[model samples]
Target: MTAHRAKGLQWRLVVVAGVQEGLWPDLRRRGSLLEPDRIGRDGLAEPLTPGAMLAEERRLFYVAATRAADRLVVTAVKTAAEDGDQPSRFLTELGVEPRDVAARPRRPLSVSALVAELRATTVDPAATPALREAAAERLAALAALRDDDGVPLVPAAHPHRWWGLYEPTRGEVPLRDRDRPVALSGSALHQLATTCSLQWFLGREVRAEPPATAAQGFGNVVHVLADEVASGGTPADLSVLLERLDSVWDSLAFDAPWKSRQERENARAALERFLRWHVMERDLGRETAATEHDFDVTLEAGGHRVRVRGSMDRVERGPDGRAYVVDFKTGRNKPTAAEVERHPQLAVYQIAVREGALDGVEGFTGRPEPGGAELVQLRIGAPKREGGDELPAVQRQPALSSYDGDGEWVGELLADAAGRVLDERFTPSPGRHCDTCSFRGACSARPEGRHVVE
Candidate 1:
């Protein structure tokens, strides 16, 4: 009870808890905005001085102390720089010498705490065998006790509640059974097979990928705008594209206003690059067969058939009436020509095309043979001539027909990837991309993630 509420009350023993320096004599100014307490006294002439306020607090403390007729106990913790609980000055003024009191050791009052104590006792090396057995028996009794809802009162005491002690949810079965085909997308082939397989397993297989960033959002907007332009839904004009970009530009989060503006400019440049490329394709007698075309096909790999499925950004028909793949890149870095030759993502699309992925699609005349593939790097500007305007950089990969045995090594990669996935062999392969990988904390190759495997 508060000191004010114990005015005329008497108790056999009274405990004045929290009699600390700052709290017992709270020196902060106290009065409503209307100054009601000062109305009958000084009429708000001036605020009460520190000495006057201290005197008032001392009198209140005296009232609380006098109410205890027989015995009184005042509590205050030892004061230090870290612990600021000092005994109130009133204790010294009233001839009470503060002395340290040894705290009584007691068990915490909670089911979890009790379970922890019992568990510790059962496993204690210093305890006798009989005492440990008694503790185990008590824990079993507690485990048997349940509330009306049927949930155990002490969950930790129950053996069934312990994780990592029982068989896994799927037992010893692989993620994808041996007989079943490992279904993978073009990008998945890159991450799972080419890059880090463990990263792919944790992020894609378990769906533990991190949230998207501002750069990702920017790339998404550019891709959508490029698609709209190709589909004739939006005009291929700079002003119109900027207007469309402004509609959702503020939705993306950036660290600063200048960064946001810079990204906006980059997006504008990407759109401009797309416009130029589109116009050039028309002039070169190349027609867009499809935009964001979905494809799914099965291929023989590593003694097992793997299902490759994904959407192509754009598929074009060349003057020779062969299907060509064009993938727009918003990332600042562009791969070298040699890397593009064996790029897993591009190889997947070409393999799908060879497997009749877009044979019956509209605007695709004759056979859907792989003519060639190119990465239209929108983020990286092309080498500018003295008087020429800025253009997008293009890195081309020749048609599969030009490669030896029609690029059969790509099939070997697919088979290897499929075999690993079927066998659930996801070993961590550390690379330059590790810095941006989301599963670094769970990867065995990383020092920070070593504890997980250990």
Candidate 2:
């Protein structure tokens, strides 16, 4: 619709403006791509002279005019560059007569067109009596916001402010390609933010991580076990499941053997319960979609691109044919539904499903969108050691704590946060979690009021 971009593309009514003298067939007398002296057999496959560039320009305008299927309107204003303008000399060459705008009498202003013009503008110009009235009406409408808040809540800074045209903010940093790529999971983004400076340092400076705790190590083991069993339709009996567990356990890197053993026993009890729950759910009609699904997606935010990866524990296809992403937690202090709604890991899986990343995945023939997600709680079932006999301290159960939300919104939020994490300016935000975080040692080096660790 802009100029001759619609060339060879027909429209019912095509309007061409600046069909005036100096604009179209914008003859740049100086620098054209075609250089005759530089052209030779070895230069390029096909080369043209300066004259040809102008010739092509004429042909483009011709093509622009002929694109009208029904009617063609070629117009030219009375001015160009603040100097008086004239119709193109080519219009006369084409035997088209010109009409003078100054000669025509003014017609009645259109109410509908005036309303349309006002609707399209953020700030209305009082072009005429009608438009002035329209502008007044627009002001009145804006004064009363749709929400209870009188003013619309819009961010003063672009979420991806690093990409703004201007230079960096007074003390802010800009995003740049680093010594290493920015790789983060949705889970990392879901954590509490202490400072912008600290996050930036962790991403760029400290890329490698230390070993996980026994609690974390056990969760990883269970995830691997769940993925393996769910992928295979092997019998969910105690012996087979325990053997698989033993194999998985042997391959793990635990914080301590004693702690690992304690977790392994708890895991074994939970696995049996999960198997029963898994089979029963299937019998009730939920089918497996994908397990241990790995995704690495590149997102473009505020012009910067970053790669995010996450492994989905399970994605189930319901009888309704919609999918649900599930992540397993085997440790204590499992998050609730509200917490899962804020989990970046699930949001990532949701984005992947919708973006065709999981198209060829199991049970997603046409790429069905994820309906929702849940944290598959498989807490440890350890018994209290009291007196001679041991008693179960907690019930053995596996439940789906559903996160009620819109996938697209959560995905967008993560994308913006990823952009910020990748952007320059790693502001440190030290908080209570720093006491246990390995980076707490580094936080102490920061300015006061933001010291991160114990």
Which candidate wins on TM-score?
1
| lDDT, candidates in the order shown | 0.83, 0.59
For model 1, the local distance difference test gives: 0.83
lDDT of 2 by residue, 1-454 (tens): 6645775478889877777766666666533566565556787445445578668778877888788889877877675455677677656654568776665434334543443344435234536667666665764454343456555422221123212235535434444454444566656655513224464456435663456666676777667667777888556576887886787576666657887787777887777657766776598688887888787776543344556677778888888777777777675654444645555556666666665657777666697766666665666332335211121122211221222233444545554665555554455565544545556545545443232221
Task: Give me the overall lDDT of model 2.
Answer: 0.59
lDDT top scorer: 1
Question: All candidates' TM-scores?
Answer: 0.65, 0.49
Clashes of 2: 11
